[model samples]
Target: MSAALRADPLADDTIAAILAGYGGSQWEAIALVNRLLAQWQSNADVQGWQAPDGTPAPIAAALQAYLAAAATLPAWADAARIERAEELFFDMSMLSCSLLFCASLPECYVVPDLAGVLHVAGQLEAHCDYRVRSTAAMIFPVMMKGGLASPQGGGIAQILKVRLIHATIRHLIVRGNPAQAAGAAVPALDAPCRHLYDTLYNHGWDVPANGLPCNQEELAYTLLTFHYIFLRGLRRLGLGLAPQDEEAYLHAWNVVGHVLGIEDGLLTHDMAQAEASFAALQARGRQSPFLPDPRPALGAALMRAMQDQIPLRLLKPFPVLLTRYLCGDAARIDLALDQRVNLLSRALFGAGMGLARAIDSVVRLALPGFSICRMMTRIVGYQFTVKFLMNQTRPLKLPPALLNQVGHTVRAWGDDPKAPRWMNALEARLAGRKARRAAPGGQPC
Candidate 1:
């Protein structure tokens, strides 16, 4: 057994206490986000078509203050390391996105509670494409240069927004139909194991009216999915990183985990730690009484949507084949992928991938700095983004009504009828604010 497993990690009670301590803060953060959304809406109404600079007066000031407080880099964070990680990330953007969507997402459904929450929330129903697009939108900005720490970048802001959305999910699941939530539950286990089980399988212990929905452990589990899972997927693709670069990537995400309210203990700093943590978590998941519902319909929907992005008909099947390849047969079956590839087709796909990898190897050997893989990633990522954005008449964004129904005040901006009105008003308000500030008074009244 790994030393980590042998160390006798914190008892269930200790973990629970830690979770409880953080739960309140998470709700408070959500409350603040709720207000921010309202403020953004109101500001947009006043400003007209121009995007709000995240500065006006109290609203912008409040958001900036919250970000400033929450966005601190962890004591262990390394600026130079983070820079290298970001470069590596852009260099392999396409593969990263593929792993996230095809591999990581499918793997997520393996966790019964997560699948239950997403299913009950209707996030996987008819609006699956929107949910996927929204998630991508949140992640892309953060991966870009200067994104995580910069107030102007979407990293911190987008993550915080996702955290709020998680809170909203917890609220909805707890308060929604009891039957549905129960259906989502894993089978009962013995008392001693129950707490750990609940932590891993159930969302968390039931709380009083004021208690939060999700717990710290659940949040940490998600952080692992993004950090460990993504890295593992890359390794599987035969894309190796320098040991320092690997650690740096993990370190950068550890900073993100800290900002997202995950405890330091759960944040992984290196590949060894990540592997141990991942194995332990997976073992716990296997103990769940329930099997995940045949991969949420959303998986298939996402695959179909991806097909539209690739121009060549021959490459249309490539996405599904790639997903199947990355996730393996078990995941494909669990996800209920409807398409079937004959042996010949599978062989062809395998050969193509092998040839591509071989070509990439030669290119890397000939010119270490120039990566054909990176070029492919850029082209593929751009095409996918263009198609995803245009999927809806209005540019798609997240925290859709399905997920945010509990917070009635929170609505999907993409589908909002008032979008144009608010947008037009925002331009006027921003212009007026600028003019007033320029006029002798130093600030707009």
Candidate 2:
């Protein structure tokens, strides 16, 4: 990461403007954060927004100004490429969910500095589900149809709120100064902050050592995890996209990075640039060891949470194995997933992977589109969707309307129009869905 990029956090503008507009009052800033939380929780539709109840006019105006500007598409944003990327994501469907849970998220925790911030703000070991769910909350909105382009799509609205949330985290952690760079160093280690809502106040962050919480460098790295790492995972599973498709996917997420207030220089458009940048940033982040070493605990908690979601005993180990497979030795070692799984799970996973690859190689000769690996991964993905995304008891903290939309999307993933009839039936039985829609894609093909 560049020194200038590392020095600046994204909150330097819009959020700063909002807080300053509120007269820089400590009580007012806190109130605004709380108010945003309340308003967002109750409202799913983001096409039109209103000032939250009891919002001071100045603060509300500042927020309105920020959203209006932040929600806009960049001058260079390509609508065609973005729509193509959306199509690719939709076609990938349930398999995308598997990659997200196993690849993108596990790799996210591999960054020491980012994990350190999560440690501070998230009692991650205890609230593992919240970490997973919250990540999905952003992802679902961003990838949903017209999520970024249309006013009706929730992506821009949710991303604007997330951008603010990042700034708010920095504000509270640094005691509203927002200038942690020049601050006196707090002691290196202190009691870990366990507060749920307010990881809100002092968590004894050594800003000189850690940079700012949710700094630009870290945010950019995370965008890579979702786009670059996810694509990389697809390749590892023998499901790589066409070059144009890959570039389109990267483009779509770079747009999201822009929305999240990440610097343009930090975003990469191709896999080669992405790999080099990701490696450089990971190396830079690791050079300064984040104390308390949050990666292992955070990794364990994430794996355990995921494992708990799968009912099939044999499949419980799949999340860890898939994560370790997608992320190589370096990340595997970092996350402490280097340990061996039970002999049976290992043997079965190893054999299953080999069979999938062998079958895919032969099948592709006759039907160039077929991939057993894709089917296998989609089945695993379906399990994650049903357990994590479709759980009625603890539905995503989305407005009722958006939650309904998400549920419909997940259910539709049960049918694959492109797959052979037999494969679709197998997918249905294995995924515990009733059956494919009688006519796939709503036509009698």
Candidate lDDT (C-alpha), each: 0.52, 0.77
Q: Write the per-residue lDDT of candidate 2 for residues 1-445, one digit (tens) a residue.
A: 3432243344445556666667656556756656674455322434355686777676677666665666576787899989998888888999998888888888889888789888777778888888888888888878878888875577776777777778777766665546534454544335454454345465656677777778778888889999999999999988888889999999999998887888787889999999999898888887878877999999999888888877889878988888888898898999999877899998899899989999998888887767778888888888778877778888997766667767777777877766776777788888777885577445232
lDDT of 1 by residue, 1-445 (tens): 2111111112122222323333355334334446555432211122222225633344344444444445456777777887777777665644566677666666666555455455544446556675676666655655666656554444665565565455455433343322224223333334342322233233432332112234454556666777777877677666667788888888888887776666687778888988888666655644442333524476776777777777766656766777776666765765677476666657767886677577767866654543333333334444554445434555545334221221221111111121223332343242222211132432221
Kindly report which residue stretches of model 1 are placed more than 4 angstroms away from their true locations once superposed: 1-35, 38-71, 176-214, 289-296, 369-382, 389-392, 396-445
lDDT of 2: 0.77
Best by lDDT: 2
**TM-score of each candidate?**
0.64, 0.91
Candidate 2: give the clashing pairs.
Answer: none
> Which stretches of model 2 miss by more than 4 angstroms?
1-54, 180-183, 187-194, 197-200, 440-445
